[model samples]
Target: MKIRFLFILCISVFQFISAQTLSPNAQVSILTIGPGSSLNDAFGHNIFRVKDPLNNIDIAYDYGRFPFNEPGFYLNFARGKLNYSIGKSNYRDVRDFYKWQDRTIKEQILNISAEEKQAIFNYLKNNYKPENREYLYDFFYDNCATKIKDVLESTLKGKIAFHEPVAFEQKSFRTLIQDNLDYNSWGSVGIDIALGSVIDKTATPEEHMFLPEYIHSFFGIATHGHSKKQLIDNENTLYEQQNLKTHNSFLTSPLMVFFLIAIIILFVTYKDYKNQKRSKYLDVILFFVTGMIGVFLLLLWFATDHTATAQNYNLLWAFPLNIVLIWKLKAQKPWVIKYLKFLVIMMCLLIFHWVVGIQMFAYALIPLFVTMIIRYIFLIQYFQRSNSR
Candidate 1:
């Protein structure tokens, strides 16, 4: 009985040691998931897959998980104070889940030494701990996709060199985002409206890794800093997204909807000009809606921690003071005329900004801009004439 007990104890220690380390057959790969239908998933995702057949380990670790049920989740998200956590799951489960979602899954087996692979695996395991898992999420600088590149750089200690892919053309962050979204979609419009000129600057080649597709492309062409060998040993498309018919109704699109609203505004202004009267209700609604949007953008720029929301030029048109002065639209005070003239000047400045490429406004807002300019001019003349009388 003593001999048997000693033998079992030795076996348990060997098993524990094996579990703590990776075998020679261990492999680390990056899994790039294709974009989904929603705006949140428009840029796709990245996961680290560590597999060790000898150790019976295959786990997919991702840094995109957030607690939706956490208190103040939505408020924190809005305030840019949300904490994203590392999540681990069986590799097969993640693959099957993305497959079921009809998203393409591409795997790039990293070309690295066994030691480097072990370091990466150990780092991920350590990061998965409850206290270490949570990190401040940044949309551009720190996100699910960028984490893949960050992990490799941190673990390998400058061993990986990302080369610019062939035929690479640099683009601004906003342009890159719009590339993944339909131009006239509401998602695109909202992004253009809320985000400011900070995203209009050209992003560096390395900065492009913020998107998962770029991470895959750049990683495929990366090289080992020391040996200069290809960083990716093999590339495999584990799941190909099915070609599904996507139906987008043009009639309901932002461009079409905004165009219709602009036409109505122009028609009302024309009637007001002919009859020598103003539509106070229409003016009130326009001011209230635009003012509210301006206030929200202001909050995003000043009140939040989002780096991309700074210096937003959308305020040129959606002036927040309009909300405060909306009640005085019909007043014949000279100040009202001055305010209308200021709005007209702001519209011109908006056009100049768009023309000079200082910022790119939503294409859907073009007609609205024109209509707003016309209405503002009309109001300026009408107010001046009223005050003179």
Candidate 2:
């Protein structure tokens, strides 16, 4: 009986040993597919195995525009859903932005004028409100960081244990920055919404304040096994060359808040006037026009703040409801109006944003241009004819 048990135990141990453990500095293997000789022969394989950044060759399996620090964990292991980068220039800008941070964000921010430093400190004091910063960071990290870690730990457990601390080195690492509405101190706060901001280590990592710092730190951990501080200072020159500053990116974030309020009033008043007149024809056309505008705002929200971070913009359903109110202008086809309203409600539950950010705002020009062409050709001609007569 003892001999039989020993043989069984040995067999179980052998079975366990056969499962390979990935090395601490091993490449991050991501699967892809290629054309097969026959339809049945097609298969997915680990095609893009990311090289360790610390290696002499320094190969980057670029994650491109996806926001998370750990590409492997964010793109593959977590949910199998992918946020693919569509534009090459767009992807390169984002990549270069982070690479700049990984290279020299530390000393760069330190070189700011005292006025800028004081301004940031003052802004943090007024805005973050102590616990709010950490609370928000933890909130974001809970969704963005912790989930990725769980996937990594869970997927690699028993197969590979993390021997090195899963944190970035603090020495060579610096906070990467970009121009966003919320953190726009670099530009005049009065205008040009996409002004830039970087994390100030002088303060406790605060949401909006500290979050950028952790982003740079986490990105280093994700890309290079080295901690944030461990990255080589010499790499920063390559980073500097990549970031060619041109005309600054702009956004109208402040005006948008006020714009929403004014439009709501305009919509309500117009509907009320039409209700008394029972203008069925005008109401019908207005519904389609307003719905298009609402969808336009949502597209900007998604493009700017990113999908994972777009909870605030999700509440922008008010834009579509304006269409329903246009229908309530007391038309015979109230059913069509009600249907449009319902559709608007459903979309509101769908769109989301991180609340504080910038957008192409110009992306609005797409729908705007289309609608304007129809209006100018018709309305402008009608006005000219009336005046001529």
Candidate 3:
């Protein structure tokens, strides 16, 4: 009786271990979630899903999870030192969560062999471990979307090939980013101002996978590098975003708001010109605001680890020296007049940069730029007349 009981216990233990392991029939797929309304969700999301019907196991692994409550979270984020971690959860729960957010979800079932599938599953499991989960996140290079392409290549021993899709038009990183955002939206304007010329370079076909939609597109047409076999076996739309009417008022748009501010600045300058006077307070405000913006941009370029904020040409117009010269706006010094002339020259340089495609500035700033140039020219003339007196 004792020998029979031991034999049964050993059999039960072996069965449990086998059941916990991924079966030969397991499926590994990429889940692409459509963009949401908010700026953070504007780029959409991507996740890896592993499903084993034989083992009754379904799990979703995501690389976008960041611990918001961790120490120095906001500071590290600002400095680009924040670490993002992989999170694993029940596949059904993840699907339901994004569905509740009214985002569309699509799944691309990979055509790789069972061995490759098991390898990817094991890779994700090991990556999900607490000591191994965290990785440095880079927006254009090491993001959630890019990880889907990277992980497959890494785990599959570089057997995957991403071919250029049909009628693919190459675009700069900035253009690709702005494609998902409204042209005149505040978010778009902020991106244009905060990021710099580094993003203006044309991205490679594989680099385009930084966006989740591109990941889905590239992976759909991908194939095994060695055998030239199609990579995707099947594709399915799990959920579709509901058609909802979104209202954006023109009055609140960045273009309209900046236009109105330009009109006000021009009106004040015209009045000052007619009276043969300088608006001391107006000069003070413009100098302070533009100077502060220049300082901030300098910080983003030099003080942070952000790759996109380098080589910003926006500093041509927003000169930081203006902050120190605010008190000297009314001075009869000859150097003050020369400084005003220098500002006008900088404005012309900014226009040259835009024309040459060295960098793309915000289109909504056209009105503001025109008025600012006029204002700087007026300051130069006004200061000259004051110095002569």
What are the TM-scores, per candidate, against the unseen true structure? Answer: 0.97, 0.29, 0.96
Off by over 4 Å in 3: 1-12, 244-247
Q: Report lDDT (CA) for all predictions.
A: 0.93, 0.32, 0.91
lDDT (tens digit, per residue) of candidate 2 on 1-389: 99999999998886554322222343332212221222111111111122223332212221123435655644342332434221122223534544544422221111222332233223323323433222111222232323223323343331222222255233210121222222322222221111111111222322222233343333232321322232212212223323433333334443343345345444544564445323344445555555565654455345443323232232233255556555354334435444545544444333222123221112222232233223223333333443455
lDDT of 3: 0.91
TM-score of 1: 0.97
- Cα lDDT tens digits, model 1, 64-107, are 99989999999999999999989999999999999888999999
Best by lDDT: 1
| Tens digit of per-residue lDDT, candidate 3, span 1-389 | 99999999999998888655788889999999999889989999999999998888898999999989998999998788889999999999998998899999999999988888888988998999889999998999998998898899998999988889999999999999999998899999999999999999999998899999999999999999999999999999999998662747889999999999999999999999999988888889999999999999999899999999999999998888889989877656778878888888998999999999999999999999999999988888887777777
Indicate the TM-score of model 2: 0.29
The ten-residue window of minimal lDDT in model 3 covers 241-250
Q: Flag the better candidate by lDDT, 1 or 2.
A: 1
